[model samples]
Target: MKEIRVGLIGFGTVGSGLAEVLLAQQERLEKRSGLRIRLAKVADINISEMPPQFGDVALTNDAADLIGDPEIDIVVELIGGIQPAKTFVMNAIAAGKHVVTANKALLSQEGRDIFAAAARHGVEVGFEASVGGGIPVIKALREGLVANKILSIMGIMNGTANYILTRMTDEGIPFDEVLRDAQQQGFAEADPTYDVEGIDTAHKLAILMTMAYGMNITHNDIATEGISRIEPVDIEFAREFGCRIKLLAISRNHGDHVEARVHATMVPERHLLASISGAFNAIHFTGDMVGNVLLYGLGAGKMPTGSAVAADIVDIARNIATGSVGRVPPLSYLPEEISDRKITPMEELSCPYYFRISAVDKPGVLSAVSGILSQHDISIESVIQKGRKQSGPVSIVMRTHTALESSVSKALAEIDALDVVAAPTVKIRILEEDE
Candidate 1:
């Protein structure tokens, strides 16, 4: 068996798990690939925290040590970020080494340049773990679903956000309380901004849309809204309306344009996406030929994400041994083929909405609210009042008929400005089965 050496950068949580997988499943992977996969070197500044499983593997404080090594056949960049990781990946490719990575942010922002570099060097870049941790979604999109024209992608891509929202909905706790608990339980980072604020989800979605649609979609192209403002009352309303509130990364391929956005979505209970709970991630994408498909699994963690990275290593090893590297482009589209598509503006997004408004318990408050909606060409499907408080405001929940986002925004603006309205109305986009 020809041996292929693999160098890993950043032996952190996912890196440690990769070490564990490589140590424990070395024989099986080599047998499956018909190529010996050797753990040649690990580069991490904090080598003290390296897992005990890495018995005698070489360690270096510098990443270039591995990138420059001519013997290293594959460079797995697990150091998550844009700066040094991007430089290292580019360098490894320039050195004629294949690359595997799990950096969604880097791939979304700088993937065009990185893929261009890989193509120039005739090296493959495998990023199976970038989006869905262990779900193997990238492979499915790049290869499995290659035969079909992808129509849309709807996903709960952020495990931290999903975990927080799941806890909130299940325990009836508030967002802050659940977030704190998630942080303590190691589900969320201390900052929690990227995951909770939908930026992380946007990065993942941009990667997916690029692969699915062959459009060079970047992270900033997706309009994002966080789950920080999700309230227990909205959860109650979701249940009442046979729905569940999930932080969703959604994108659709309209004939001439694409709809890409990340926001808190009201998914119906009957949909497969609604069943995904806890720290789990689920992607529901539609294809022209195959119709709807659902992939569910752990979105992030030690073993799950590492398992994904290791799978990519197996793929790269197979490519190297077969002497057919660069068979698949990084974004599943050749560099010249990835053209810029128009990302649908936020104001034009059309969806049914769930609105929670707090208003003074006055007679014509409903009339005033409806008047604003009518003025903006917004129409209501159903409305229910959740009883009144003694002296202050009462909650009114309304589900609107499908309306343009601009109209809803303008109506909400007019409604919020009314003296009877207590606060800015809470709006959650409803994802219906038809869509």
Candidate 2:
């Protein structure tokens, strides 16, 4: 049997778990793939704290040792971020070594350059663990669903954001409270900016869009909105409408342009995406032939994500064993076919919206608000006026018919400028069941 040596970098949570998987499952992997897959070396800044399972493997602080090694066939980069990770990946590709990575942020931002380098060097790059952890969505899009045209991809990609929203929805807790609890529970980081602010989801969405639509897009191109603004009252209103609020990373392919946005979306309670609670991640895909397919699993963790990394390693190893490294293009499309498609501006997209307006508890407040909506051609579907206070601000919740986002913004601006309006109107887009 052919021996394909593997070098792992960044022996952190995912790297350590990958080491365990490759070491523990060595027999099974080799038997299944007809290749001796070996975890040959690991590189990290602090090698003194290396795990016991990797005692038999070589360890180093400098990543160049692995990249320079002639026998190492693949380099798996788990060290995330843009700086050294990008440098390491480029160096590995330059060395003519197959690369596997779980860095969504780096890939989403610097994928074009990395893939270009790999193409130039006649090597392959496997990044299955970037988006959905162990969900294998990448392979599904690249291989399983290749026969069909992908219509849309809506996913709950970030575990921290999902956990906070799920807790807030189920327990009626406020956003800040749930966020604090999530941090204490290790579901959220100390900053929590990337996950909560939808940056993390946007990164995954960029990767998904590339794989599905072959669109040359990045996270910066996505219009991102976080869940920090969501409150218990919004959750209650969503419940009243028989829906749930989830921070959704949504992308749709129009023939002319694509729609990509990450925001808090209200999906009907009966929808599968709505029912995906807690930190578990789920992606709902609509394809021309497949209709709707849902892939659900833990989006992040040591073993689950590591398993994804290992799957990539095995795939690359098999390709190496067969002398067919670039059998599948990194983005599941020919390099020349991937082009920059126009992204539909968020303002031009039309969808039903949920609005919570704080207005003075007076009869004219509704008339003023409705007049603004009517002027903007935004028809109201339902209205619920919460408990009133004498000449004090009251919450006036309204669900509008399908309205252009620009129109909604214009109408909300006019409405908020009214003297009776007490606060900026809270707007959350509604995802219809059929959509």
lDDT on C-alpha atoms for all candidate structures: 0.90, 0.92
Instruction: List all candidate RMSDs to the true structure.
Output: 1.3, 1.5
- Give the C-alpha miss distance for residue 44 in model 2, angstroms: 1.0
Candidate 2 stretches greater than 4 Å from native: 388-392
- In candidate 2, how many Å is residue 54 off? 1.6
Residue-by-residue lDDT tens digits, candidate 2, 173-282: 99999989988988898999999999999999999999899889999999999988888999999999999999999999898899999999999988889989899999
What digit string (tens of lDDT, one per residue) describes model 1 on residues 128-228?
89999999999999988988999999999999999988888888999999988888999999999999999999999999999888887899999999999
Candidate 1 residue 422 C-alpha distance from true site, Å: 2.1
Worst 10 residues of 2 by lDDT: 47-56
lDDT of 1: 0.90
